[model samples]
Each structure stands twice: as structure tokens, then as C-alpha cells.
Target: MREGKRLGRVIWAPVGAAVLSGLVIGAAARLLMRGIALAVGGLTGMSLAGTVGILVVFVVLALPAAVTATARPVIMHAGRWVTAALTGLMAARTGVSDAKIIVLADDGQLTPITVLIVAFAAIVVLHGRLAQYLTRRLRTLPESPAEVLPTPDARPV
Candidate 1:
């Protein structure tokens, strides 16, 4: 319902929040995936062939997912920033200024157990959304001719 109407600089609040949240989720997801792998593989004990297979599956599942999950909000925020910057409105500052320091201090910490719980939840949610988004995005991409399997090498399409 609130998609339309700039409502002034308040727009940045949501946009900035999403991007920051997304980056946090991405880092968390990668760490979680790595931890899962380490637990299942024990850091050094899985057989080479099995480890390779697991790794291939992990890459197929995780990398694109993490990227898309983290990228959507970033792209949206960039669009907002670009438009606002051009319109002589507020601009995003990527500096270690006092305000940034305050924001970081405020947002970067919590009770340790609460931090772990929230971080785990964020990563899992982002992973699910990322997988869905990436699957849809991949489906929308054009298939390359090379990806088409030849008909038994006996017939050409």
C-alpha cells in the first residue's frame, strides 16, 4: 500500500534497512552453510569423491542463492539513491563519519544469544527467499544453444 508516493526522505529508511539487512543475511548464510558442511564432513574426513559431490551440490545450491538474496535489495536501494541524488534530494554517504559510527554501534550488537538466534533466523529466511528468487530468475533466462542436448549424436536440431 505504501509502494507509491515518495513521502520524502523517509523512503531511505526502508531502502537502507533492507540493504544492510541483506548483507548481514548473506554473510550469515555462507557461514551457516560452511558450518553445516564442516559438521557433516568433519572438516577433513569425507572421502574425496563424496566430498567433491557434496561440494558440487553445495555450489549449485548456495552460491547463486546467497548472491540473489543479497543483490535484490542492493539494486533497489541503488535505484532509489540514484533517483534521489539526481533530484537534488538526500544522498547516501558511504563514510565512517560520526553518524555512521553511531549507526554501526547501535545496530551491530545485541545480547550474544539473541544475536545468534536472530542471525540464524535471518540467514535461513534469506536462504529460502534467495533460492526461490534465484530459481525464478534462472528460469527466466534464455537457454543457450549449447545447453540443448543433441539427439543421441545421430540427429541435429
Candidate 2:
């Protein structure tokens, strides 16, 4: 029983961390997508409601991608499932049935999946690089001695 409890504790911490990180990344991605949608909609003279719907659609599609791209493998796989479910719900709510949008092209023609693949690849690479940089920076910080450690005069005889 004790061993089982210990194992549960060890397992739960990483799972909890992954979930928390996924939620945070999802929210950040939603905000970023919302801002981008708002800017594009404004430039193209889309209606306010239309812009909001665009943002909603972006959030639905991008959140999971961002989380999966940035998170650990287990979380990444789970994020795909979560994304599919949310895409359905958001599509229903926003009246945007299709989640796929082709935005990039070459030779004056639209390239079906190339743009999306590149964008996701860029996002994943950027996220991974940023995480590595932050981890390296954190590792290089000097550790301070604990206050509980005995000083020369405080040492036991």
C-alpha cells in the first residue's frame, strides 16, 4: 500500500505539471490567435461579429497545436484528442464548420497543406528552442547556501 501510494505520488506530479502547462500554453495560444485574427479582420474590413468568430475559430484550431507542439509527448498526443473535441464544439458554436484554412501559396497559386505544415513546424521549433534556452539559463544560476547550514561559530564542537 505504501509503495503504491509512493508510486501514485511520483506519477501524479508529472501528470499534473503536464496538464497545467498544457492549459497555460493553450490560453496563451488562444490569446495570440485572437490578436492575429482581430488584426487581419480589421485590415480586411470584416464585421465585429465576424472578427470574433474568426478569433474563436483560430482559438479552436490553434490551442491544441500550440500545446502539442510545446508540451511533452504524452501531453502532445492527449492535446490532439482535446483539440478535435474542442474544434467540433467551437465549429458548432461559431457556425464555422470547416476548420481547415489555406493561407499560403507559391507561384500565384494556393498550396494546400504546405503552409500549415510550415507554420506548425515553425511554432514547434521556436517553442523547443525557447524552452531549451530558458532551461539552460536556469541551470546556470548559482545556488545559494541554505540558511540552516551551520556557520563556523555555529558548528557543533
Candidate 3:
């Protein structure tokens, strides 16, 4: 009922933040890289459409881990920022490299950026699952019994 809805919100909120952060990171990275590419020459590996596609893919790749990681309150509130930043960096770097590799492949200069992306995505997904598992285990663990301490009175002394 209300608890379920509250739990849902807690889980979903970080996911929303991840989506937002992904979009922002992707757009910013694209803009910065585009500027650098243009400055070097008439070079631009990824088009606007490619940037959009990569951003979409990045969001998809990030969602699973984001969901699992958000299960913890501290992670949902604070750790999400760190996760977002790291994931964003990984996405941006991989996106740029992938685009460059695609351009190279077009000219018969093929490279394997897909493997890099796959590996990175796998790490993110696995890490999230591990965090969720650890949290669940901790929650299920029994607390140790407290020992009773006797107070000494003057008579006892």
C-alpha cells in the first residue's frame, strides 16, 4: 500500500537522476568533443544523431545498476552523485571512442570499441547487483545479544 509506493519512490528516484545526469553528461561531452574536433580541422567523427543515439544507449546501459544501487538510502541520496559522475565519464569516453572507431571502420580502419563498452557496462551491472546483495544480506543478519551489566552497590562491595 503506502509502504510499497514509498519503496517504489525510493528506488525510482535515483533512476530518474541517472537519466537526467546521463543526458547532461552526454550533451556536454558531445559539445566539448565537437568543439575540439572542429578546432583540429574539418574533422567530426560523430554527428548530432549519433550523439543522440549514444545518449540513449548510455541511459539504457546505466538503468539496471542505478536501480540496484538505489536500494540503500545513503547510496540513493549521496552515492548516486559519485556513481553518476563515474558512469557519465565512462559513457562519454566510450561514446567518443566508439564514434571514432565507427568512422575508422568506414575507411576500412576498423577497431574494437564495442568490447570496451561491453566490459564497462558489465562492470557497472555486476557492481550494482553486488551492492544489492550485500545490503540484503546485512539486513537479514541477526543482531548479537547484549550482555547485562550488574550495578555494584556499597553492600555488595
Clashes of 3: 0
**What would the C-alpha RMSD of candidate 2 be, to one decimal place?**
9.5
Cα deviation of 85, candidate 1, in Å:
41
Going through the candidates in order, what is the number of backbone clashes in each? 0, 0, 0
lDDT of the candidates, in the order given: 0.39, 0.43, 0.51
Stronger candidate by lDDT (1 vs 2): 2
Candidate 2 global CA lDDT score: 0.43
- Worst ten in a row by lDDT for model 1: 87-96
Q: Please provide, for model 3 over 1-157, each residue's C-alpha lDDT reduced to its tens digit, 9 standing for 90 to 100.
A: 8577556555555556446545654565456556444433436788778889856755554554455553567654344445545555665676676475355443222223344345445544443344344434443433333323443553374
lDDT of 2 by residue, 8-112 (tens): 544443334334434444444444444434433323344667655554544335345343443586766566556545544543443232222223223333332
TM-score: which candidate is best? 3
Model 2 lDDT at residue 138: 37
Model 1 agreement with the true structure over 75-149: per-residue lDDT tens digits: 644433332232111111211222433243422232432354355554444433544344344434434565565
